[model samples]
Target chain A: MSQYELAVILGMTAVTFLIRYSFFALGDKVQFPPLVKRALRYVPVAVLTAIVVPMVLLPDGRQWQLDWRNAWLLGALVSAFIAWRFNHLLAAMGGGMAVFFLWRWLLA
Target chain B: MTTTYHPTRHGELLQGARDSLPMLAGAAPFGIIFGTLAGPSGLSLLGAMGMSLFVFAGSSQFIALTLLSGGAGLAVIVFTTFVVNLRHALYSATLLPHVAALGQRWRIPLAFWLTDETFAVVQHRYGAADASPLKHWYHLGSSLAMYGNWIVWTLVGVLLGRSFEGLDKLGLEFAMVATFTGIVVSLLKTRPMVAAAIAAGAVALLARDMPYKLGLLLAALAGVVVGVLLEGRNATEEGQA
Candidate 1:
């Protein structure tokens, strides 16, 4: 591997590992305040939504594609609805991807 | 569903792997796509596999490849990786109470293998109303499954990319969105949780232009604050009623 590539991989590895391991390393040494614990309860929902919303709404990461041509938004909506209704992971993904590919083909 | 039933560690481990099946399905395409694109994005074979093995976080690895392709500097790539993965810190903290009693050896590997899929499944397993002491084994099973799945698929994608063309543009990454949507939807058991999701989505849209993906962090904070405040209000109303 090139020097630059190695550096990039190593840097990413260190940073990602540290972030993931930080709290586990501290363990019971640091007790979170009750308020912090309450906040932590919402982290998964909040973070996942934050990541998913923009990806669906702005697939290009630069512009808002809210129209029908945006297969991502449509597929994600279908996925979310299926998940809410059936609460099945495989169903959500399968239904969503099917819609996404079918929508793209229709558009094309 | 008997109250007296206790699952052995081996059973828990296998159960964890079984529970991760859907997530593995969701992540398979993503890992393969990453493997296919890594080469075109200027990563050597060793570098790409090294990343899948060492970095092990799909989103950050994809982001790093994007930044590298864009000629971003080393520091920029690293900083963005750190910012994007800050969510894992929250995950680790959330699971810490369950794992705090384990030794460093267990904690270290568990932390290393803690991906989005594992966290989604393992956390639910931990939250289940069971007194099984083998829950950690469940976590281990889920982690190893995801880890092995990622490495193997990445290698497959690398080889497949060498033979095929245009696999990266197929929108397979949407699998991740679909999977995450399922996870978040299931987690929305309470009104506050639903409100937090809506709040986070709105704020993330508004703050999409923030540098270094800080918008994600800001959106998550906003959601957490809204959820906590709403929960507190609900508690107070209950007391008054």
Candidate 2:
């Protein structure tokens, strides 16, 4: 690997590890405000949506793929419905994949 | 009310492992895809394995892999992944008081092991009325189980990548999306929660063109701001009433 590539790897390893380790080490020393604490409750839902939305809406470029042929849109709906109806992550996953595959096959 | 069942450390650990199974299954395909993506992206065997072994954060690793392939600089790669993984600070803060009594032995390892999937299960686990000390073991159980799962699945992905060519095209990643959707919906027990998710999705979409995946962070911040403001407003309304 080149120096640049090696540096990127090592940098990632160091930075990510330190960030994950920080609050545990310094948590007691610092206390969060009630406002911040309340907001923290939304972190998971927010972060996950932030990650998942762009994939279904704009998988490729900077625009929404609001078409019927959008596999992600179709599969996400199937997955979201199954996920809600079953309230099971694994089942929702299975249902989503099943729909996604069928959708892809049908499109093909 | 917080002291109902006091499970022994062993039981908590075992329960922790069992509860993590659903998220584990959700993550399985993701791990495999990451492993497979590593090779064609010019990552060496050591690089792929070392990343999973060390960083252990999925989205950041995926981002790093993409940047690596694109010949992005180390600074950019590090900064981007750091922003992506910054949400862990929120996880850490949320978990702080629960694990406060545990010493460094528990704290250090659990900190390293924390992940979105593990936290999804663990935050609720920490709330079991009879939970306190046993919760630490439970944290260990869930985190370590996920740690092992990622490693094993990444290995499987690395191996499978060679033989399976069309896995990405197979739309298998939707499983993770589906799993996340389930987690998101389940957590939306309040109006602020609903607003938070909507704000996040909308902001993420709006900020999609932001460089270095800053859009993700912007979206998260937007959600938190909206949720917090709504929460404060509700508190004031209750006081007035």
Candidate number with greatest DockQ: 1
Question: Which pairs clash (backbone N, Cα, C closer than 3 Å) in model 1?
Answer: none
What is the C-alpha lDDT profile of model 2 across B1-241, one tens digit per residue? 1122446888778778877775677677778889999998888777888888888988888988888889877788899888878778778877887777667887888988888877776776665445356688878888889999999999999887767666556555565666676667667779998899999999999998887668888998898889889988998999999
| lDDT for B43 (candidate 1) | 93
Q: List the residue pairs that clash in candidate 2.
A: B2-B129, B4-B130
Q: Write the residue-wise lDDT of candidate 1 on A35-107 in tens digits.
A: 9989988988898899899999989888889898999999988988998898776687779889988999999
Please give the distance, in angstroms, between residue A1's alpha carbon in candidate 2 and its true position after superposition. Answer: 7.7
Model 1: residue B64 alpha-carbon error in angstroms:
2.8
Sorted into a CAPRI-style docking class, model 2 comes out as medium
Docking class of 1: medium
Over 4 Å off, model 2: A1-7, A59-108, B1-11, B37-42, B70-73, B127-133, B159-161
Q: List, in order, the clash count of every candidate structure.
A: 0, 2
The fnat of each candidate, in order, is: 0.85, 0.68
Top lDDT: which candidate number? Answer: 1
For model 1 chain A, the run of ten residues with the poorest summed lDDT: A86-95
TM-score, every prediction: 0.85, 0.82
